[model samples]
Target: MTTLPTSTQKKLGLVIDLDTCVGCHACVVSCKGWNTENYGAPLSDQDPYGAAPSGTFLNRVHSYEVQPDHGQAALVHFPKSCLHCEDAPCVTVCPTGASYKRVEDGIVLVNESDCIGCGLCAWACPYGAREMDAEEKVMKKCTLCVDRIYNENLPEVDRVPACVRTCPAGARHFGDFADPDSNVSVLTAERGGIELMPEQGTKPVNRYLPPRARDRTEDVDILAPFLDPIAAEPQGFMGWLDKALTAMPGGR
Candidate 1:
């Protein structure tokens, strides 16, 4: 079993806002595109065009319809990926020591070369973040776009996870949680960000901002204005039409 570092220099992770996400799946597509083209082995799809298609993806979006106590039902889009937990079970569960957490940034990663596709990591992850690559026969999960973030050649603005960069709704944020002044840190505090399955004792670095309460429609009359006429005496084409209608059979 692999051991976790006592502490990390930086806690780098994602902050997702459930209210802002639109369930477009743009982040999922971008993650697949970027990881396949640049990072490690290409993600494989089995009979992609066929009826039963399956593929490897590090990121995914799930939609759920939630009913509030006094308001209407709302649809929430939740994006899931590796949380890079401080006490990651997947890391310690690996018999080959292929899974490890970096002390520098607290990013849990699997050394693919040493992986035997034992599926231990997948089983250990409570969030269902890990998956077995169909073609490579190895485990795959979100690396937080490590190559992109640290690449000196890329623009400073582009130095974030693929999902964060491609999120059209700006729902995903990437930053160092260790820094109190970081955007993710401030957002978490302000929005009351929550951990996924806190009872699991994983101490996940990633946080999720809950959706705000929506306006209730029970007391609102949307067509109230239309029901009442704006003018007591109609004029122009509308006036002519009203007069004609009134003149017709039982048209008062």
Candidate 2:
């Protein structure tokens, strides 16, 4: 058996590469795909292929347009998920001990068998990490693909979580945060990473490295193609009428 490093006295975590993430939803899709099949259930959309659709996800990529005081606009993609905090409120607030942090690794998990379908854990989490599994009447969150990560049957290179493996831009990493010499540790040290919502004092193990300084000229050039005045205007009276209608309060 391949034993995990002894340095993992404390739980390990992930370090996301924000600079390299392309805002592709591949990680999200892969997460839904892997977890749905392996875990209790796949993330489900209430109205899939319909007018209004939404569902649960352990991972999600958020796109933000960051405008610096003296620089050009930057399109930043943030993949949000459970940081698997050292002082996880989700675990403490669980009245049924359903939400627990793993002793073997730092990964937090929900035991559906023990859960009472109470939403307290969801309310306690500031990051919106926990989602209700409506079908099972239990809270659901990321498992970090515990089954696959250490599976001896899988190839050595495929041991990482599905989200990390599907990241085309190479923005996701999984490793032991407890090990000072681990790859995630080394990357965070070199990149001067920052944690989200540090004020909450959950002591999240995951880190997000700030995006690199981008060139203003390049940013403007990227946005220039969609800004043509001629293209912005529509064809004929119907177009003008549409714009006028949109001008009405909350019409747009």
TM-score of 2: 0.81
Model 1 global lDDT (CA atoms, 0 to 1): 0.93
For all candidates, the clash counts are 0, 2
lDDT of 2 at 171: 92
- Residue lDDT tens for model 2, 1-252: 111122336666788988999998999999988898887755666777899877888888889988888756889999998998888888888887778887779788888888898899889889988899756677889898887798899999889999999899899999988888899999999998788899998888899988987644533467777877675667799798988899999998
* Native-to-model Cα distance after best TM-score fit, residue 71 in candidate 2, in Å: 1.6
**Cα RMSD to the true fold for all candidates:** 4.7, 10.8
Candidate that scores best on lDDT = 1
Residue 225, model 2: lDDT of 75
TM-score of each: 0.87, 0.81
> Per-residue lDDT for 34-82 in model 1, tens only?
9988867788999999999999999999999998775578899999999
Model 2 ranges off by over 4 Å: 1-8, 215-252
TM-score of 1: 0.87
